[model samples]
Target: MTESETVRLGARIRAYRTMRRLTVRGLAGLAGASPSFVSQLERGRTSASVGMLRRISGALGITVADLFNEDDGAGHRVVRRLERPELPAGPGTRKYLISQRPLQNLEVYAGEFEPGASTGGEPYSHGDSQEILLVLRGRVTVWLGPPAEAVANTLAPGDSVEYRTSIPHRVVNDGDGTAEVLWVVSPPTPL
Candidate 1:
């Protein structure tokens, strides 16, 4: 990396660390680095090798590429359709990670569910996030809270729903064909 790139990377690291409210020592512990080393990296006094950058980004719950792909404009970038990272979304379902890293407080994903497929298995919760589900195609039945609560809502194409994610939630696609939906979350907790 050039000297300018190193400094820019350091600034990005500092920004993310501060956003997560982690002390330099805490981040160092997570990244398996000495606090002094972290300090030097943050001050642009040293350049982190690729392996070191990988460990640090992993500690921050971000991919190593995210460390170098900082958006140049007001945090905006157009994500190409085929470039999204695919993630598991239970049986017969596929999810695409839509937002690049350093997403600030936002996380976005697109999910495609086959008939009877769902974001099931174990219902999950995110303590620091709230989510908006926008159905782009097909239909879904979203269960709020635990399965026992039975609080549910069925959403069709063009419909959207917002919910706090502090309680466990899951969604099922019982429609005839594949279901596609976009999820937008605040204070992004990864999928």
Candidate 2:
């Protein structure tokens, strides 16, 4: 892979890894690789083969296409609109369009949250699903369970987080500036 492609792949790997809430060591073990290998792959220092990527994707319960999809202008793509049926969680938030319509068995959105905003504060569940969140700006706190795994991790423009939808998870904007996230959910909700 070229430098740019390597970087993109690394970003995707990191995104999926975070989405699954798997540590480097954990993913490496699951993928039959070493921790250093996973770390290097996530940093773009190494390139992953199709086999490796397949294993990783399988472990994450996602299809290979999910890791390599480009924006193809499918369904109804929206820009900055706030009148749609936005998921009820987090005040002072907006969800822009990343996909045209919520078809194709998947959905993606550009989420913007003002400072001190949050999502799904009342402990909700979404059946059996998964969510991937890439932090495009500022910092946010993620709570992932009733036990409440407080992820105070700060994400810069290129950081991300992913987790199973079976467990209740919520996000809160904890930075001084607004937080922007690219959120992708699989198995489109019946809305």
Candidate 3:
């Protein structure tokens, strides 16, 4: 691989690794490689053999081809509407994954909730990711932090919010009709 290609490949590895919350040492152990080796790969200091790429890809729960996908403006990708993957969320809620394949450091999903639908019964906490929810239709109430002391924000169309993933959060369709929302998370956390 060329120097630029190596760097870009390294970035892809770093993105997925962080999304999976794995340290260099952790991924190295899983790939049966050394921490320094992983670090050097991430820093574009070395080229991996097909065998090594397979090991790393296996350790990252992805395929070797995923590491070699054509760059979307250097990892920025366009996820078309029809191409977006559907995800299982709550009942009466339609969710679509927005990140283009190879699953990088970003996780984005668009959701449509019918009346009486919700994200879940309780809030959820995540690692060190940042989350943003933008309302595209109707209304919804977002509960943040502990249930007893939660702060509720009723959002309408065009409304958006940014919050820390450390705080427990959930969404409820507070409208009489269907509601739509776009959620984006950075350093993407698991569902």
Of the pair 2 and 3, which is ahead by lDDT?
A: 3
Clashes of 3: 0
Using lDDT as the measure, the top candidate is 3
Which model is ahead, 2 or 3, in terms of TM-score? 3
After superposition, which runs of candidate 3 have C-alpha atoms over 4 Å from their true positions?
A: 1-12, 15-37, 40-64, 70-80
Tens digits of per-residue lDDT, candidate 1, 77-104, equal: 8888998889866779999989776666
RMSD (CA, angstroms), candidate 1: 3.8
Q: In candidate 3, residue 136 scores what lDDT?
A: 97
Clashing pairs in 3: none
Residue 122, model 1: Cα distance from true site in angstroms: 2.3
Which ten contiguous residues of candidate 2 have the minimum total lDDT? Answer: 96-105
TM-score of each: 0.70, 0.51, 0.70
lDDT of each: 0.83, 0.71, 0.86
Off by over 4 Å in 1: 1-10, 18-55, 68-76
lDDT tens readout by residue for model 3, 1-191: 68999999998888778777889998899889999999999988998899999999887767899887765537356778887889878789989988765666677889999998998999988765788999999999999989989999999999998998889999999899999999888866643
Ranking by lDDT: 3, 1, 2
Quality of model 3 by C-alpha lDDT: 0.86
